[model samples]
Target: MASNRPAESTSFAPSGTQTIGFASRTDEGPWEEWNPTEDSVRPVRGRHRVTKQRGGGLARSSTVLGVGVMAAVGAGGMATAQTGKPPVSISLPDLSSVTDSAKALIGEEQASAPKGSATVLSTAGVSTTEAAAGTKNAGEALRARIMQQAESQQDRIAAEAAKAAEAAAAKKAAAAAAKAQDAARTKAAAEKKAAEAEARKKAEAARLAELAKQFALPTSSYTLTSRFGDAGAMWSSGYHTGLDFAAPTGTLIKAVHSGTITQAGWAGSYGYRTVLTLDDGTELWFCHQSSISVTVGQKVSTGDVIGRVGATGNVTGPHLHLEVHPNGGATGIDPMAWLQSKGLNP
Candidate 1:
């Protein structure tokens, strides 16, 4: 360590009255005083010029020299073990140039750097940046995977719901169809029964109407001598062919029921015959009449006087031969039972 001690001062008189003092690191005690008379400041040969005590160049140069010596000592220590030669060292008097260049590099980095996430990555180290990028990528991938799985699950659930809805709809449709079919069947059966009942009623009405048109005995005084199925030698078929009404020939032959006279004339076997046809296609034959007051196609009312009783055809004398034909067929029915069907006992 160098001692910070003040040395002896020297005085110099440059003009008649101007005075200057100087001090140094080394001093001998015999101080000198002199007058310096010079026109300009100058340097001595082989030495640097000394100026006033301003502490400008000398201080700066000394600082540079001390840094250089320290760099040299450190380099020599670093090189001594392997090689006898010392490593080279260079020192700058002012480090502002290198620091300015470093600042320029930082500015360029700032100017050309990316913004947002990329800007953060440039300042960070390699391991830190890589780890951050990997973490971000992993997070994004995991989110994407979760979204895809969610979409798949949603699609599966939607498909299942659709299938269930379709099944329910089909089941409802089937049940409705079955119910409709049952209703239709029941309706059809009821209609069939009603139609059958109506048809039977119509048939019965028509049968009664036909029976009313037949020539039955007006009074119960007549008797049945010739039945429809009695075997007889007088008939052409060797059987009794007509229903007989054995009344006196002159007895009033009232109209059997409401009808039109289809024929009223002298027929060969059934002389003075009268055929009356009812509306429902039944025919009444009155034969062996002494007189016929009705003509063909003549309309008549029930109980009206149509003819007089007579034995005009192949029959017993002074009797009426009467027969009933359904739709004008050859065969005849029993007069007694046929008249009874119309609520009349004969």
Candidate 2:
């Protein structure tokens, strides 16, 4: 054994001062594997290396020591340059956070490891390497992305369906309410029409009952001969202008109601005619009478016999022609309707 020691030793650091060392993010494993004399340690960042030595072992040792100091001070990163074994990368945890396992490794290296030696890295498998590298297969990445997208799409579709269901329900309720409103309006209209008709009927009945006590027929023994507005050329007017009553030539023709006799005598085509005037200036003419009992301006009461029926002047037969001249107008009205207006149905 030729002095198992270095030929020389050197350091760039000042004399008798502690060189700075660095803490790394990776561990180098066991401590007994480093031997700069046989293995090359390449500089990681700047220019320096602890290369294998064939001559001047002491000087090589001194250089390796210098490189080691740089490595300890975190001179970027360091690794053995020779092959056969992979280049070893070495680091340390933060001194404040060092675990028991890391502390044991450091203690073992300081107590048993020789000078100019490095720590060797050992791994369980490729899977462990891959885990440290944060690598995943293509299939696994794709599967995770697909699962996230599927979940998102499903949530969106479910939300849309819920909104559609709610809208349909609201529409159905509105339609039902509209239909109910229409039905109510129809029912109310029908009820209003029925009520109005009933009221009119009652009013008419009451009027007729009152008029029954105030008026009487002109001739009770006569038969209906013609109606007003009858289309015939039997008179000067194409349409008959009066209501007619047929009876014996000598039948009694009474005054229709209490009134003054304005004229009583033969009056041309209205031969043996008599004109009665009411309080409101309405005129009543009785024509085709056999004889007249009252003179002009003579007052007469209702049901008083004022003339006898005859066919003296423009008459097809013995009949009394009664016409209504409202306000003594030249044009007479439909006698039947005029009588009904007074609550007398004839």
Overall lDDT per candidate, in order of appearance: 0.68, 0.72
Best by lDDT: 2
Each candidate structure's TM-score, on Cα atoms with residue i matched to residue i, is: 0.38, 0.56
Show the lowest summed lDDT stretch of 10 residues, model 1.
119-128
The C-alpha local distance difference test score for the whole of candidate 2 amounts to 0.72
- Cα lDDT tens digits for candidate 2, 244-320: 98888988888878889998887899888899998889999999888888888888887888988899889879999
Residue-pair clashes per candidate: 2, 6
Q: TM-score of the candidate numbered 1? A: 0.38
- Compared with the true structure, what per-residue lDDT tens digits does model 1 show for residues 87-134? 655543444333444344434545665654332221223233554567
lDDT score for residue 212 of model 1 = 60
Residue pairs clashing in model 1 are: 249-309, 249-310
Q: What is the TM-score of candidate 2?
A: 0.56
